[model samples]
Target: MSTPVPLPITWSPRRNRLVLLPLSAAMVVLFTVMAFVLPANWHLNDRVAMVVSGLLFAGVGLMLARPRVTADEEGVTVVNFVRTRRLAWAEVVRVNLRAGDPWVILDLADGTALAAVGIQPAGGRVQAIQAARTLRDLVDERAVPQDGSTTAQG
Candidate 1:
């Protein structure tokens, strides 16, 4: 029989964010230029405010595009726009993929749910579902057996 294919140790969105980084940078530049070139019947504070707002917008864009999920032998790490969380493989009780959901949600043993922003439905439903399945498989492979033995195969 053929050997089993190796499962991925990590999972992330199939879509690349490289494009967003540059696009957001361009927007910031455009806004900065407009702040100086666009004539507005307003005070200096208003101009500064406009520029700062533009920068904040760009920052948000960059932050949203930087989300990622990484898994290893020990646990998984999820990096969202505002926060990063790490959960051991044992802590993940279930993986949920629902229709109309933007991303995969992980149900933890602690009665909390964690959104896997890295596995976004925006990458296409098929891809997102496959990613969720892969994550589930990883969790199963790392699960602890009833006898307190580890199930990790690699």
Candidate 2:
């Protein structure tokens, strides 16, 4: 038997730092400044608190900035944070690009939605859209139809 080819799949955070990072940093800075302005006794627990809070914020920042893409003969895999989901080419119903935010909304056969972040919103180069469309077509081609039309409906 021959090895199967991989379907092109791309994954990225829905948004990179336009919202998460600054807010996290603000929280850290706010608390650190608060600790400084407050009286020493009140500040007793502040330093530790700030450090802990800062670390938490930093973790979130890192998570939000992480983006990855993987494609294999079976299907595509999109990973976000601790959650990683995959879809077989036949399982993908359609690729939707019209929305307030940018994402690859995968309509699965089981009525589930798998969204690939950052692929939406036109944030990347022109190639991003092209790549997304190509993947969409590939998924559509392999997708199983529901109404007997042989074409996957989204």
Best by lDDT: 1
Give all candidate RMSDs, comma-separated: 3.0, 6.4
Candidate 1 residue-wise lDDT, 18-67, digit = tens: 66777778878887887787676767887777788788888887887877
**Which residue runs of candidate 2 sit more than 4 Å off their true CA positions?**
1-44, 99-101, 144-154
lDDT tens string, model 2, 51-122? 677778777876766555466667777776557777676677777665454656767778887777646555
- Give me the displacement of residue 100 in model 2, in angstroms: 3.9
How far is 67's C-alpha from truth in model 1 (Å)?
A: 2.0
> Candidate 1 — which pairs collide?
none
Give stretches of model 1 more than 4 Å off: 1-10, 14-19, 40-43, 152-154
Q: Cα deviation in Å at residue 80, candidate 2?
A: 2.8
lDDT (Cα, 0-100) at 74 in candidate 1: 78
Q: What's the C-alpha lDDT at position 36 in model 1?
A: 86
